[model samples]
Target: MTLSPLVFAALIFALVVSISYAVLVRWLPDPGKERLAQLTPGRGSDHSTLWSRLQKRLLAWLLWLSPWTAAMSGGDEETPSALRVRFGHAAWRSPVALQIYFTCKTLLTLVLPLIAWALVEISPWHPQGLQRFLPLLVGAAVGYYLPDWILSILVSRRQRALLHAFPDALDLLRVCVQAGLGLDAAIERVGREIRQARPELSDEFALTGMALRAGSSRAQALRQLSVRIGLKDINALVSMLIQADRFGTSVSESLQVHSDALRTQRRLRAEEAAAKLPVKLLIPLIFCVFPSLLTVLLGPVVVTLARQLIKPVG
Candidate 1:
């Protein structure tokens, strides 16, 4: 018997996919050549390699498929500056990383629906037209939004780490300044000393130092730090520093005051979280723990009462 139209279509699709995979595997350069090219230092040597040319062509194809990738990647006037700042806060500083992110989004958006459709088609259940397309829509939507969710998680985690490190960093800076070091020296010293305890904060401080050393004004560097951190507290601190620098105020005294304030704020946050713990636990207790407890406590008693009440009449 001849195959149905749907079956014929599926067989053709599978053949195409198989052929594409075979071609790619056979044509792509070996991993050894790629590594050799990497080891060869000069651009001329690397670019001349077969693997490098293949890699470039592959990258070009991906870029063509996702032409909007570079535009959304970063620094586009149309793209929100806040998003670029968020990427910095998340420690994804490479310009190419944004392109890779958008490329992933594009690939997922295109690929997931096809996969969903193929799976639905091959299943014994044989979903109807609308039902078959439903998974495709869902897959596309999820694929599109997944990157944003992942980025948000990264930003939140980094912000929390920086928050935890800030007060200690402030204390270190204060001590260094009090010992007669200049502001830049105090910052650099704090960065080095706090590296073990708070790597994220140390990195931020180190970057700020680098910017300062590269001849950027202190105010400009501090502003950049605030942008990188994307924190209100850092913004406030940057503003305070700029003001102090303008007026020639004692840096040590300012740091000391800020450090104390941060400590107080941290303490208050801890206390607030502690106070909310019981409330947070209430739902779990009612839904999970209480049911188990009630069953354990009343189960035997209910059983005995049931037996007594159901006694047979003579």
Candidate 2:
């Protein structure tokens, strides 16, 4: 088959575009480096410690890749060392890792368009040569940022999963405390008990426990937990815990009450969604189902009427 000029041009353009995308990907920051930098202690006894050395190597490799990352990650604003230290606790490990892991997914936005183009090119149904450029352009644009968009979706899903498990975690904590464990012991117990069912929450709880054991205050650990999840429910729970601690209230009672409230709120949310189901269904019924029903029910009558009316007119 003789190759057309337009097809030849598109193939060349795709090659150049793919190369540019690869360069852009190489220039993006490695999330693992940012994570390590945030988690590393600023100054310590051993600057040559194994983890510290590893972090340094990672940072060096990351910085080597993109000179822009240093600029993008942070600017000249001088945050206190103490304040920067707190950021590690606030960052949700999953979301950051999520963004890094799926950054390459953006390339998929090109797949459908490329496939369609190839199909049209080979098949007898091929359109005029000039029309082929449109799909390729749209595909490239969509594919270029698909990864970033997918990462956001993943973050949302992870957040929802955390929220779903939170009430159970609170209930477990309440039970542990009611069984005579102290607040710290109760938190540890809850973390251990819910490890399988609510691993994310369990991990956060365990981290809080670790921080507490490492000499941080209970309030500080709880605050960190709230920040890490970045969830309103976690914030409310932390606020309640803080108040209970300050006011000498029963911790178990406080947890139990919060758990009950969370459960109630979840139930109410489910009911609200169920109530909206009919409204949500209406559009589909009008556009799809209703039309199909009318076609099926009235189709024969219309055909018969057309035949009778036409014979009389003829």
Candidate 3:
């Protein structure tokens, strides 16, 4: 019922920070104008509109120091960064937006753990300090990478959704191709048709079409498509397309086969996940569900037995 000193302190700190952030945002420059300044690494503006500038600076500082930010910028040795694939062409054209993202992430990393620690400490079932701190540490780590993890998850889910929709897209493309459209035109038409339902795949296909229109070879466009989407299925599809283009094969037949193969792979993946459910459930059953069941079933017996034994002893 009553808040602890620590909880009160955190609440106060949060309120002050919120108010400060509001005041900062009220009078700031559009980070878009200063985006290059932030990216270029120079003596940045001392002030943007005033409030927004501080927010931007705070964000820049956070981005400058965050583990996630640092990790994002680093290159993978053999495999190119998936982040680059996903976001390489995204218009992160606003410095303020970038800073805001980092700031939010940093606050999540810090505040969630503190709130978690407070909740754990105050709980009637509060475990030992070691046990409690373990959760806090886990919460902190989860919170820190949470955004990137969510982004990765969204990308994964989007890819799955696209894979699911790929058959329809492919069928449409085949129709277009059969109806006298060029390969590129067929892809463009299919991309447009599926834009709403399979934005992830549609966007990549559109971009591929754009690349081809811009005079990139079909192979190059397909390769770029594979790079942008960053999925094994898409990569395989791209390779197939490239090979078909190179060896004078039937694009429609090749696509039809690939679509069927993708659907099969998706089905197999679903089965695999379903098979994993029992293994995943075992831990919770053992650690959580069983204990509660044991308490309910044996608790009264234990109490009665204890009373019987204690009475005889007395």
Candidate 4:
């Protein structure tokens, strides 16, 4: 029996999906190994899989396709460094990720306009003259900046997560220090303990702990942590810790004070947001709710008046 076109198409799609899934499974790293490597530092090397190598090559080709654009936007010393810093702030530390991001931006910027133009040509409402070019231009502009917008959103979310977890991490650190753990040990313990609750903060702390273990000074590790996080609270905490270490002050006391201050600031922020709720709602209330309400209440009256006037004229 012959299959219908729809059935044939569905079978083809299912085959494609299954093949893709199989390839992904083969190429992906073993999650168990990855987790083990993360938990136990220096035990195993993170070797690149075949899939990762292929992906890197593809991204390189994409970059090579638009050398001028990549050079102008990301290849320069200043631009690459800034992009790396931005990636770190967003918790994405891979340099190759930046290359991939630029590659995607370039492809989108070129491809979207072509796709838009093709769509316009095939559309039933065949646009004429300026309309034909307008969508293409708009699509190109949007595609060019889409990566930047996505990166900004990622950075904001990461920063917000860091902010939300900061006070809790500080409290944990203070407790650990008070219980006689060294600062480095306390950081490691905090990272391990907070892994489930705040993965972002835990990762930062884990990196700082690794730096400390790798023979970096406390001040240097803390400073690098501040740079990676790019948060005022973390910077101030790093400075405070450095000062406390230099002056032979108690680490626990400093941490406790900072944690309390952070909590107060967080509360104030919450209150400020609550206070702005009414103002933010005002626009929706006026434009949406008020219009619907007025239509409902006055619509019948207007209809009745119109009927009465029409009857008199008749």
Scored by TM-score, the top model is 4
Local accuracy of candidate 2 as per-residue lDDT tens digits, 228-296? 777788799899999999999999888888888888888998999999999999999999999999999
TM-score of each: 0.74, 0.62, 0.58, 0.76
Q: Positional deviation of 296 in candidate 4, in angstroms?
A: 1.7
Give the Å error, residue 38, model 4: 14
Q: Rank the candidates by TM-score, best first.
A: 4, 1, 2, 3
Whole-model alpha-carbon lDDT for candidate 2 = 0.71
CA lDDT, every prediction?
0.83, 0.71, 0.73, 0.85
Q: List runs of model 1 lying over 4 Å from the truth.
A: 1-77, 114-131, 311-314
By the TM-score metric, which is better: model 1 or model 3? 1
lDDT of 1 by residue, 1-314 (tens): 76676787688789989999998786666656656767777633443466667877876776676566665554466667677777898999876565667888888888888887886676554667677679899989988999899999999999988987898898888888888898898889899988767989999999999999999999999999999999898788889999999999977788778878878888998999999999999999999999999999999999999999999889
Candidate 3 per-residue C-alpha lDDT over 120-174 given as tens digits, one digit per residue, 9 for 90 to 100: 6655445774786886787788888887776667666766676677777877887
**Number of the candidate with higher lDDT, 3 or 4:** 4
- The TM-score measured for candidate 2 stands at 0.62
For candidate 1, the per-residue lDDT at 152 reads 98
TM-score of 4: 0.76
Q: Which stretches of candidate 3 lie above 4 Å from their native place?
A: 1-83, 89-155, 304-314
